[model samples]
Each structure stands twice: as C-alpha cells, then as structure tokens.
Target: MLLKNPQILYALFLLIIPVIVHLFQLRKFKKEQFTNVKFLKKVQLQTRKSSKIKKWLTLLARLLGLACIIFAFAQPYLPETSQSLKKKETVIYLDNSFSMQQKGKNGELLKNAIQSLLTALPEDYHFSLLTNDEIYKNTTKQELAKELQQINYSSNSPNFKTTYIKAKKVFSKHKNTLKKFVAISDFQEQNLKDLEFDAQLENTLIQLQPEKNFNISIDSVFVKDKNIENTTVQVNLSSSTATDQLFTVSLFDHHKLLAKSSVNFDDNTKANTTFSIPTSQDIKGVLAINDNSLQYDNSLYFSLQQNEKINVASISDAKDNFLKKIFNQDEFNLITTQSNQINYNKLSHQNLIILNELKSIPQGLANILSKHLENGGSLSIIPAETINEASYNRLFNALNLSRYQKKQTEELKITNINFSNIVFENVFNKKVRNFDYPKVNSHYYLNTGANQILSYNNGQPFLKQIKQVFLFTAAINKENSNFKQSPLIVPTFYNIAKQSLQLPQLYYVNENNNTIEVKVKLDKDNVIKIKDSSKTFIPLQQHFANKVNLTLQNEPKSAGNYSVIANDKTINLLSFNYNRRESKLNYANLSSYKHIKTQDSITNFFSQEINDNQMNFFWKWFVIFALLFLVIEFLFLKFLK
Candidate 1:
C-alpha cells in the first residue's frame, strides 16, 4: 500500500475532535421523587449503562469514518511493483523478424503485438522503439504509431543479448530516475539464450506471442553440378511437426514452371529433393513449397550464369601437335606462343596457362606467372623431354611447386583415377576396371605435396593437383606417354578450364556475410550496382586484380533474381533468399523471467491497469461512510432524547 498524496493525511488530526466531543457531552443529573425507590434505582442504572455503550459505539464509528475520509483524500493505492518511482522512460522492442510472421490468436504475431502496444501503452512514459534492423529513441506515441503501420518483416534477426545490450545503452542516456523495457516477440529459445539483464533496468517485461499452427519451410536450395545440360538442383525442406504429410514442391525459371515434385515427410524432421532443368543460358530460378501459413520461408530463389569461353595460353619451345589436337578452337581460344616470344600481358586474361614441354622457364616470366597464380589463376606444368633440371627447379622453387628429379626409365601404366573428383562427377556411368590404361615410359621422378588425380602402376603420381595448379609428371608426347591419346584427356583439361571461372553460389543469405565476389573487373569510372525488376541500387564495392567484391547493404529485401551490373553492362546474375533460422517455430519460456508478469489478452491488461485500478478511486465509498456515521450520531442525540 502507498499514498499518492501523503500530505492530505494531516487531516487525520481532525478525528480526535469527535472523541473529545463524546467525552465532554454528558446529560445533567436531575434528582426527582419516584413512586418505587428500588425500581427507579434499577431503571436509572440500566439506562446509564446502555447510554454509555451507545456513546462509545457512536464515537468509534465517527473516528473510523473521518480516518477513512482522510485516507481517501490521500489517494492510497496497492503497489503493483516494489519500485514506487514514477515511470519515465519505456523502451519497447518489437521483433519484426520473419519468425514473427507466425499467426497468433489475433493475427500475425508482429501485427498483433504492434496493435496491442498502440492501444494499451500508458501515455505518461516516453517510448523508444527498437526492431531487428533499426532503433528509434524518445519516440512520440503518434510517431511510433505511424512507424508501426510501415513496419514489415526483416530477414536479419538479432538475439536477445544484442537487443538487451542496445536497450541498456539507450536507457543509460536518459537522465530519468525510472526506466523500463518491454520486448514483444515470439521469444524463440535460440534467440533468447544467456541474456544479461541490467540492474539499472528497474522494470522489464517480455510479452510472448504464442504461435498457433505448425510451419513448413523450404530451408535451402542449391545447384549440385552446373556443368551438365540438365542441371540438378537440391532443395532442403523442414517441418515443425513430425507428423506424416505430403507436400508439393515446384521449380520455376524466369517465372515459368520447369518441374514439380511431391515429397512425403513421415516421422522425419527434414527431407531433401532434387529437380533437373535443361538450361544453357544464364537463368533465374525459384523453388517453392505449398506451405501457406508461413509464406516468407515457403519459397527460395536462385540463379545460374551461362558458361563462358575459357582462354587457354600454351607456351612451349614449339607448337606441340598433341596440345593442338586436345584444345579445340571451338571450346578453347588456344593461344600457342613460342617460349621466346611469349607475351606477358596475355597471361592476365587467360584462365589456364599451359607450360607445354618448356626447355627452361625464364626468371622474369616465372615471377609474373607466380603473381598470376596467386590471384586465382590456374597453371599446368608439362616438362620437356630433354629438360634442364637446374632451370626447371629454379622456376619450380620460385612458383612454390614441387621440383622435378632424375628421369626413370621404367614403363609405368596409369591405373588409378579419382572417381569422386568434381572433374569426373557425371563423366562415367560405372567404374572403370581392367581396361587398357594409358602407359608412360621414361617419366621424371618428382617430389609432390598434392592430391593424385591419376596414378601409375607403381603408385607414382601421374597427374597431381595443387592449389590452382595442375602437374603431369610424365611428358605428353605420343612416344613417351599415351596420355594425349587417351579418352580422359578431353574432359580432364576441358573441365579444368571451365572450373577456373569460379561458379557463383546458387543463392545468398542476408546475415553477417553480406559480401559477394564476382569474376568481373572494374575501373575507377565503373560502378558495381545490383538491380531487380522493381528496384536498383549501387552497392559498395572494391576491385581486385580480376574480380569485384560487392558489399550488399541490406539489399534484396525480398527473394528473387538480381543482376550484378558493371556500369551499364549486366556482368552477372545473383540469387538471394531469406535466412531459415526463424522457421524452427520454437518459443522461449516466459515464466523464467524473474520480475515478469504474464497476461493473455491486451483487454485484460488494460482492465487491470486502468479501469479497475488507481484512477478509478474508492474515495466515494469512504465519503459515503463518513456521512452515514454522522447521520447515525445525530439520530442517537436527537431522536433518542
């Protein structure tokens, strides 16, 4: 219990006046003769005793009534909180993340929370509005109401710790003595772990909006092998419940339906499905499931870029006939240059540079090739038959590749092939066995620290792959090694050139990683911009030697195909989708908060806080009691006499 105006309680001194009046007032004794002296004495004693009891009862009632009147004037109230200070600042965090899209009893959890805050918030306290993306301090009710109408779901989500830290900082700036924080969210348990509540925050309230229905979401979508004509897309799906159900999953390319499949989810939490689409050019795709309740995560978007021509630079003592036959002009722009007249500038544009049977590598050219390989370029080394070991080792040591040793005269047959390599992902239908493998004669012995793609019968590495560099220990001459005539030569070198163009990911999630690198060069005058059908904006970017790294600042708010444009040219296409963390549909236990109170309906909250509380005073009943006591006292004095 507490008093709003304790100074009015000084009127309680007036209660003593009633007791003094009762003590001072006394009936004067009148002596008179009676017919029966004994009967008169008995009657007089009974009357006096009854009179004293009535006077005391009336005096006690008057005193209590006056005290009640004084208490009413003081405006006493029951303390709802132990902290009696007036509320000055109220910070309200409204979770607008995609998880808030779940429907509650009222509607969507976010919208319901916003409406409740608008209607139930007290007008006395100044408010601060915080969301997943932005925070507004000292906001007016009208301004906040307007902002609430414009609020929508956000792809980014901040955990409770971050939100609480932000609120504590905002509260620290205020000079007010009393402060409070109210967080309105579905309170997903994952986002509410290990939160530190500041002691300065006197009052903290977490309003939990309960979700009614389970949700099914398309967790992710990606492309496995983009090289084939029929590209296979993998779609990962998740459900909130473990019940058995059938759902339709569909795929779309440029708004046209490409494939549709049905998935059966029985007692499983997650499932994955694959769909194939025949595409050759750069195309935009969307993967969707028939989950209507939570529409935000039901669909995902992705894109695939067209295959570009690979520029292959072949430097050798002479134009080797085997190399010319392997790198066809249609697929590869094979620039065969003699070792003496090799143009260094052409190395910058070439995806894969071949050192085909070089007698010796020049020091100046070796340094340039080292720099090229460092900047994500690929190199293939094939030693000459009459090789100078010292010159080759000098270049090999400088380029950080393994050095060639003395030549071995033994005839070695290539037997082992790495079947799981991406280079041979879809190349073979069944495993190769005792077929006629390629043979190498008089191959060089080399020190290697790389994975062996092809091995000889004696377990020596025939073909090795280092980081961005490939090496063949055996020379690819028709007489020395039959590798040039083997069937594996076409796909092995061709795929290496194709893979040199770093394939962009199928889609991006809007999280801490907001940067995406594209294989396109830019100048000072050129700018990297992202655009969709509806909107366009220039993103912050930095230029590397051959690629541009763009930082997406809260871009692609909705999922769809986006174009990465360099100046006026559309350099590449990108896909974006919402983060799937919110699809878990798990909620935090609100009862765990120390000083928290829970109420189901906003109406009940207002009824208890406003209509049935302090503002609706009980003072009128006390005033009536005071008047009734005075009336009873008057009746005892006037009518009884």
Candidate 2:
C-alpha cells in the first residue's frame, strides 16, 4: 500500500471545513408555540431524532467521498512480491548458425524469429544480442533491426556452454538485478547438450521446430579412386524421412554441369554417388542436390590442383643408389649434398631433409636442421655405425627428442607398425601379421619418451617420431641392416615427406580449424589472401622457406570455392564448406533441465513478460470507491427525510 503522489493527501485537510460547517450550522432547537402542546412535544422529539440520523449519515458519506478522491489522485500501487526490488535484465543469444535455415510454419526459422522479435518488442526495449560470430551489447530493437537483417548463416560453431559464458559477461554485477539468459535456436543436438543452468540467473530455451516432414543433406564429397584416365568422386548423402530417400545429385565444374546421378538412401541413413571425370585437368567442382530441408548443406564445394613434386635433400657422401631407387625422379626432386657442400640458407626449402648415416654432425648443420623442424619440415636421422653421441644429443635436446644413450650389439627384428598414426591412416586394408621383418645387427639404445612409429619385437622403438622428426635407432646401410631393402621403407619415409607439405584437401569444413598449405615462393613483404566476389580477407598465415601455411580459423564464412592469391596472382583454389553436423534433424530434450523454461518463440515470451502480475495499480479501485460513496450520500440526502 504505497502512494505514488502522497502530496495530494494535503487536500484531506479541506474535509475539516465540512465538519466545521456541520457544527456551526447546528442551531438551538427553537421552542415554537403550537396549537397542541402535547402533540408538538411528541413531533419535536421524533423530528429531532430523524434529523440527527440523516445529518450524521450525510457527513460520513461526504468525508469518505473526499478522502477517496484524494487517494485516487495519489495513484498508489502494490509492488510485485516475487521480485519486488530486483530490476530485470535480459540477455538474448540468437543462434544464427547454418541449422537455422530450416523452415517452420511462417518461414525460415531465423527470418521468422527476427521478424517476430521486431514486431513484439518496443522500439526502446533494451537488451544484448549474441550470435555465434558477433555480439551486440545494450542495444535497442529499433537499432537492431538493420543489423539483424544483414545476418547470414555463420560458419563459426559455438557450443552452448561457451556462448553462455560469453553472454554472462555483459550482465551487471549487482546482486539485486535479476538476470535472464534467453537462448533462441533450433536446439540442434550437436550444439546444445545437458545445459546446466546458473542458479542466480533465469534462463529460457526457445526451440524453433520445422514443419517440413522430410530433409535431405549432402554429407560429404571425396575422391573414391583416381587413375591416369579418370578420377572418381564419391558424394555422400543422408535423409531424415524415408518418403524422399532417392534424390538426383548433380556434379558441376563451377557453373557448368558435368554429370548427374541418382542416389537411393533406402533404409540406411547414408548413401553415396560417384562421378567420373578426366583426371588430368584441374577441377573446381561442386556437388549439388535438391533438398528443401537445409539450403547450406545442399551443395558442397571442392577443388583439385596439379601435383607438385616433393623436394628431398640428403646430407651424405656415401653410396646413394638405395636412396635414389626409393625416391624416384618422377615424384621426388632428390638432391644429395655432402657435409661440406651444404647451403644452410636453402636447406629449409626441402620438404624432407635426410641425414643419411652421418658419422659426425657439424654443429652448424645440426642447428640449421633444428630450425627446419621448427618451420614444419620433416627430418629423418639414420645414425652411422659409430657416431658422436655428444653432438647428436645437442640436436636432440634442441628438437625436444629423446637422446641416444649408448651403443648396443644385440640384433633386433623391426616388427609392429603403429597403424593408428595419421601417416598410416587408411594406408593398410587389414592388419598384416606375417611379413619379412627387417633386422638391424647393431643399434644405439635410444632412451625413453617418443611416439613409437615402428617398434622392435622387444618393444624398443626401431623408428619413432617427435613432432615430425623421425629417428631410426639402427642405421639402414647395406652393411649394418637389411632395412634398406625392406618393403616398410617406402610408406614410412614417403608419408613423412607428404605430411610435411599438407596439401589442401578436396573440401574443408569451414567450422573446423583447418591449416591449408600452399606451395608458393613469397617474399617477406608479401601475404596471401583468400577471396570470392563478395568477400575478401587475409587468413592467419605463417611463411616458411618454400611455402606458406594458411590457418583458416574462420574465413570465407559461406560455403564456396575461394582463390588463394599471393601478390595479386591466383596461385591456387581452396574450397571450404559448412560442417554437416547440423544436417541431421536431432534435438535436445529441454524438459530435463529444471532451471530453464522452454518456449516456442521470443514473440510469445515477450507477450507473457509484458503482462506480469506484479504491477497492481490501486488507482482504478480508488476511483470506483469514490463513485460509490457519492451515490451513498445522494441516497441518504434524498430518501432519509
């Protein structure tokens, strides 16, 4: 019972005037001579009783009516008991991810939600809006209308917990302020799961459901097989409903359609279609399918470029026939340099640097190789029969690799391949138990702690890697070991060189941390830029001796084939697509969470919030009371006499 205008209560003092008039107007009952004295006495007593009753009732009603008018002007109200003192603060996280392309009753989920918010919210309504890639703080809906219209499906994938922490920072630190975190999304299962709410803040999860019955998504595209004549590309597809399992998939070379194929998903969630095209020509390809579910996943962009030969540099003056046979001239630019003939400046240009049976390492050569490994090149060390352990250990310490303790005469068979390593992934069809195990007659006892790539039968590592640095304990010379002739030598050495120059893939997911390696020679002043017609920006790049590593954290936000430009020259084409994680129509069950509420849309939530029961104004009820008191006074004055 609080008064809005307590100063209006000063008018209550005016009621004293009516009381003074009632007292002053009261006159002594004048005794009048009448025809009958007894009759006059009886009538006088009755008249006095009736007049006093009517006067007192009229005064009571008049005083009440005046007081009610004053109270009505005061405009008192009862504050909300739920959050009487707390000021509400709303923070909204609108998920503009690729999954929001799904259509609902009105239109696309994102567009419909945006329109509804603009319509429901007032122009001066203030709140913070957070999207996956950008944040708008303490802005009004009128200002947000223009920004919201410009939002596209973002490639930046943000989990719920991470977005929550980022959103919570924009709220006020006052304990008495009530905070509300509203997350509006399609609530895809990959993005939001097991959301634990903060006790101090209120939460709302608004899930926009699509009305469409069926959804088809282009899962991925990869090279199935390739030969001199043709390259076969496999495009994977998936669907939510069985009614539309079969879809026509088209392959395109930029805008020109190359081939068309139909894929039937049947009962399985996954199906693939293949297209054959000439392998000799570089391809800027796109795999497209007609699906109404999500437009972003309907087409996947990819590219293929001409192969570049890997440069291999060997530092040895010994017999080079075995090395020459393994690294042929067709695929490798193999150069053998002696210890004295080494050019330290050009050593980092090679994709792979081989120290082939170096009896003693020069301090300067070891130092250059150390920098080579740091620049993301590959290094393989084949120790000699007798070596300087002290100099080798110095290189080892610089590379953060284990040291060679001492020499061992015990012979060991090189068995056990770490097939799970990224180098051997998909290289082996099945585990081979029986093979000609390479043997080493004498080897150094390499000390502990390295990722063992090829281990001996006794579990001692024959070959191991420490961050692209390959070390073989036993020398692979014809006199010391027969590992030079072993079949394991080809893939073990080739993958090391291939992985060093990580070529751009067929297509990369833009929602992932992808490092695309481009083979180009650029001066220190130059940089690389990836651009299409609509967007152009420089990616985070690190230049080495021969190539540059372009780390695509989040660029080319849309799915398309973009050109890699160096010094205004188009050197290569890199393709990026949105991740297919949002393609599947899976959602989280928000009912399991106790602290948050589930709503259909922000429009409905705003309606409920505007009509809060906490604002109970007493002014209207006071007006009604003033009218009733006036009627009571009228009835008393008119009918009581």
Candidate 3:
C-alpha cells in the first residue's frame, strides 16, 4: 500500500471535536428528596450504566468511520510489486509497412496506433521510435507528435530479424541503466518467419494491432513471354479468407483502362488473371484488383521494352550454305565473315554469335569472344570436322569453358529436349507424340559443367547451355548432318536470338535484392536519374564495362512506370511495385508470447504499472462509510434515550 498524499492524514486530529462534544454534552445530576428512596437509587444506577454503554459505542463508531474517510482522501493504492525506480530508456518500434493499411473500427491500424501512443505516453518519458525504413532517437513529446504525423506507410516489409537487429543497434548507443523495449505491429505471420531475439530482454513489451475485417490483395504480375509480339501478363490474386470471393481485375496503360474483368472464385482461394497485350511498342501498365481494405497491394506496375530486330553474326572458316540461309536478311541483320576476315569491333552490337567449324581459335579471338559473352551476348559453339584439339583446348582454357574430348563417330539421335526450359515457352501449341528426333553423324565428347537442354540416345548431351554460352556437340551442314533441315532448327535459332536481347524484368521489388543491372554503356561522369511523371531523383549507381548497376534505395516508392534517364535521354522504362509479402495477411499468434498486451489493454496496463495505480480512487467508498456511521449515531440518540 502507498499513499498519494500523506499530508491528508493530519486531518485525523479533527476526530477530537466529536470527543470534546460528547464530554461537554453530558447530562448534569442534582440531589432531590423523593418518596421511595430505595427504588429511586436502583433506577439511577441502571440508567447511568445504560447511558455510559451507549456513549462509548457511539464514540467508537465515529472514530472508525472518520479514520476511513481521511485515509481515502490521502489516496492510497497497491503499488507494483517491483520498485526499481531507475531512470528508463524506452525504445518503440512502430510497423509502418504497407500491410498496416488494414482498417479497424477506430481507423487504419497505423493511424490508430499513433493516436494511442500519443494518448498513452507521458511527456517526461523520452523514447526512440523505429519504423520499417526510418528511425528517431530520444524523441521529446513535441518532436514525437511532429514525427508521428509525418510518418507514412512504406513499401519495404522488413522481417522481424532485421527489425530486431536495427532496434538493438539503436538501443546500444543509449547508456541508461534501465531500458525498456516495445514493439507495436499487426504481427503478420511472415514477419516472424526469421525472428531472432534475445530471450532475456529487460522490460520487453509488444502491442499487437489486430485487424477487424478480411483482405484480398494482388500478389504479383509477371510477363509470361517477351519474345513474341503479343505477350501474356499474368496477375496473381490471393485472399486471407478460407471461403472463395469475387474480385474485379483491371489492366491500365498509363492510366488509360485497357482491359477489365470480374473473377468468380467460389471453390478456389488463389486465382490468376492474364491479359494479352501487344509488345510492338514499349508497354507501361498497372494490373489492379478492386480491394478496399488494403489498397497498396491492390495494383502492380510493370514495363516491357519493345521488340527490336535481332543482330546475328556468324564466324566460320568457309561460307556454310545452311547457316546463311537460316539467318535470312529479311528478319535478322546477319553478318557472315570468314574466320580471318572477322570484324571484332562490330561483335559488340550483335545479339547472338555462331562460331562455326574453325581451324583453330587464336588467343586474340578467344579474348574478344569472352568479352562478348560477358556483355550479355549469347554464343553457340559448333565443333570443327577436322579440328585442332590442342588449339581448341587453349581457347577453352582461356574462357574457362570445358575442354573437348576425343571425337565419337557413333550415329546418335537426340532423345530428350527439356520442354520446361524458358527457351521452349510458347514454342508448341500442343504436346507432340512420336516426334522424329534429329540425328548427329559425329560429335566430340566434353565434360561440360552446364545445363543440358538436348540429350542424345546414348546419354550424351547433343546441346548444352550455361548462362550466356551455348554448346553443340557436332557441326550442322549437309555433309556433316541433316540437323539444319529439321523442324527444330528454325525455332531453335529464333529463340537463341530472342533470349540474347537482355529483356528487362516487367517489374522489380527490393524485398531481398536492391540492385539491378542495366545493359547500357554510359560516360563515367554522367548521372543516372529514375523518374516518373510525378517524381524524379538520382539513384546510386556503379558503372561497368558495358552495363550499369543501379542501386534502388528508398526509391520507386509508388507503383508505376518510371523512366531511366541519362544526360536527359530516355534510355529505358522501368517498373516497380510494392513487395508482395504484405499481401499475406496471415497474422502472428500473439497468445504465444508470454509478455504481450493487445492494443486495447496496453495503454491502461502501462498507466497502472508506471503511475503505480494512483488513479484508482477510493474516496467514494470512504464517503459512504462517513454517512453510514453518522446514521448509527442518530439511531443511538433517537432510540436509546
């Protein structure tokens, strides 16, 4: 028990007033002669005894009730058991991720949390505030209110491990002996997947902001195929509820409505809506879903570059008729040159290069080709019929490619093709059965550490690809093999060129990756800027030989199409959307934590603990006691007489 105002106890001396009144108001006695003196003496003794007993009872009741009233006025309460009054340093982590857009009965979860913190926290208690992407240290009440009002939701959704590490770093700088850690969030289940924390943190607190209604969100948007003129844009939608729902999906091109559709999902929980749009010109668009609860994830922004003509270059010892005929000048910009007459300077602009049956690879040529592959150009290696093994091995060693083994003359057929490879996507309208496979007359055996896309009947790889390099076991010509005449040759060569274009991703999110490589040569001193119609800012970037690595930090904040400008030239269009992790509204099971309070109860609990329950007034109880005791005194005066 503790007293709020011990000085009120001094009022106890007032009890003597009642005692003095009792003493002064006593009845006076006089001696008088009367008949029957013996009966008179007995009556006097009995009456005097009864009067003394009543007076004593009334005095006891008055003193007891008066003491209760005075003690209540002093404002006594039960203090928290622990009396550690060390000056405190409190750290509060407020989740301002996109998922906090969830609405409750009061308002949005983030807004409600700010209001609660402002109302509950005291002026004297200086604390640190941490959001997903920003931090404030030792903030005063005025500063806190200003910062809280400016705090808006962010696209970043940092996991609990990252948040915990950041909190630890911020709190470590403070030298206060008594420290308190408080985290307030919606506690989405994914946030805790990688949670790491010290179990023995002192005075730790967590305030979970729960959601009142369910939510549906647009999970992602991906460009299915960028090789074709008409590409499919697939939009993935998800819901928090177990039952199915109906949602409207809309596709917009620069704020112009391109396509709209309603999805009926009665038995399915997740559904995909795809739109076929032309990629003749650069396409910048947003795939949206009509979800009211969480609008941040309802739309996904994307951009796809226009399809340009592919440049194909072929270097061979002789003019191969099949290679020339396949790479027609009508559709492709083909550059055919003999090994001795090859132009090294023009190779940089070519999308795909075919190295035909060369007598030997020179060190200079090997170095140039290696640079081509590094610059995102695709290379195809076709072994020579009468090859110089030592010379080929030297070039192979220079490029870090696998050396070829002795040639095998066994007649072999390509038995398997990996249809699941992205290169084969949209190649076939229907599954093929009993299809004729291409045969190779002779091929060199190599232990190439690469992905085998086409394999032979004898378990040897006919074709293999690794990164930007491709390998063929044998040469393709009328004299060497009939593979050039096969149906697979046209699409295979076409896809090779398609894959080398270095297609930019439809959209990117900085959940785990913060950097993207753009294939554009720029002056070292030039600054690169990323901008939309509304905002523009310079991004941190690193220049490479033939590409630029741009680091996205607190950028592409909104979902939309953005232009990458260098020296005021619109070089490329880039798109970014909010991280899809926020779409998963599966919340954490707060009951699992031992020391946690819901948003509704945490404020009151903090007051009780910090203020020592002083607001718990008992004066009304004492007032009732004071009135009741006076009634007892009245009863004695009226009846006992």
- Winning candidate number (lDDT): 2
Put down candidate 2 lDDT per residue, 1-641, tens digits, no spaces: 88878999899999999899898875888888988999999999999999989999999998998899899999988876666435778899988987888889998998988888888876756799999889999899888899988877776767888899998998989887889899989887766664678978889899998897467888887889888788888888888756535689999889999899998767676788888989887878988999877888889899987767788899984666777877777568888888778888678788899998888888887678877877768998988889888888888877787888678888889888889876676778998779999999988887645478888898888888877788889888888888878887778777877787887788888767788888888998999999986889999999877789988776666789988899889888888888877777787778877788888877888877765524677988888999999999999999998
Estimated TM-score per prediction?
A: 0.64, 0.81, 0.68
Q: Evaluate residue 315 in candidate 1 and report its C-alpha lDDT on the 0 to 100 scale.
A: 89
Count steric clashes of candidate 1: 0
C-alpha lDDT of residue 623 in model 1: 81
Name the regions of candidate 3 deviating beyond 4 angstroms: 1-80, 172-179, 194-197, 202-211, 222-234, 242-246, 272-281, 317-345, 362-364, 370-378, 397-499, 510-527, 540-554, 593-600, 612-641
TM-score of structure candidate 2: 0.81
Candidate 3 is scored at a TM of: 0.68
Per-residue lDDT of 445-502 in model 3, one digit per residue for the tens? 9774447877888777877876777788887766777777788887777777767664
Error of 2 at 296 (Å): 0.5
Instruction: State residue 96's C-alpha deviation in candidate 2, in Å.
Output: 2.4
Output the TM-score of candidate 1.
Answer: 0.64
Candidate that would win on TM-score:
2
